[model samples]
Target: MQLLLVFQGRKLRITVILGAHNVRDREQSQQRIHVRQWVIHPKYSCEGFKNDIVLLKVGINTSPPAHLPKPLNLFLVPSGAECEVAGWGRTSLTGNGSNVMREVELKVQKEKICQQLFKNYQPQSMICVGDDYRKKGVYKGDSGGPLICNQKAHGIASHVPYGYVYPEVFTRISYFKPWIREQLRKFSLQDLPGSPFSD
Candidate 1:
């Protein structure tokens, strides 16, 4: 799978490390991946739940590793579809986060049900997934990981309740497709070499 190289935090520097396994020393394991550009959805808000997607442009032209290819989610994901959520997040509600990445299967919940569970739920931009009664889902430190359905990157882990009691929320990629396309267009106009901007 093609990896999205993101530069965040106060320093804003490029660094990479494999997600599948644990690294003993983060600084020593660093591998730099260039980022052409990135854009956070204009309507996104830290204080609110809507529009929590971000699109990144990586400077890589090589074929993806092995059988992994870039995922495309151009259509709306239907509710009840089984999706995989993977991340280096907490294994349990009160447990310490994992060093190695973990993945779990979850079913997408209906928007109506999600709205009932969360008063501020944004059906147009956000999706809710996981077991409503069972405590199985993405937890702390899982934000920003991919939610894969049918081998397509359909969602981004956005939020979960403080006590990890509620179903995990995700920013629906299909809902923000227009904005994503617009951002790619804007970035491509700059004509940067090896820019990862394509339909």
Candidate 2:
């Protein structure tokens, strides 16, 4: 169990390294356990910012394998896609500190709310993940967490609009699997024979 330490700000984060990130096909990469930690979601590319994006593919400094241009290949799941959202961010608006790192299930939103929220942006490239105002929304510290759908990662916790209130946002992984692989291979790979996403 080799641990890779990622330096951010004044703290160091750890990552478990295993195999060459190999897959029988590109689709396999989509099902692999999402390991994107502190990268930026390319959606903010307009600012000439790259590292600010958090991704499910690899570290914040890199991009997915060239072939996998889709930032989130698994992000846009079929209707009725059941997913889980996890984080160590915040449990409430006024929590003195982050809540215990946790995971919660959320149904992908399909209502017109999705349409209305992005009336001024590129809505097709992005997907909505939460509607439960009481629970499952990302708060102050839960950035770059994984959103798993069907036991596979679907998106990365990216951002929330209007102060983490009603609808929160996530970076779709379904659209970016191929490119993610390209960017991640340079880091390190893991060979989990019976791992959850090894199929």
Best by lDDT: 1
C-alpha lDDT of all candidate models, in order:
0.71, 0.51
Worst-scoring 10-residue span by lDDT in model 1: 62-71
Tens digit of lDDT per residue, candidate 1, span 37-75? 567777777775677877656665433522221225333
Q: Candidate 1, 126: how far from true, in Å?
A: 1.2
**Local accuracy of candidate 2 as per-residue lDDT tens digits, 31-58:** 3232444344444553312222443333
Model 1, C-alpha of 190: deviation from truth (Å): 1.8
| lDDT value, residue 32 of candidate 2 | 25
**Model 1 alpha-carbon drift over 4 Å, by segment:** 1-9, 25-31, 62-75, 132-134, 192-199
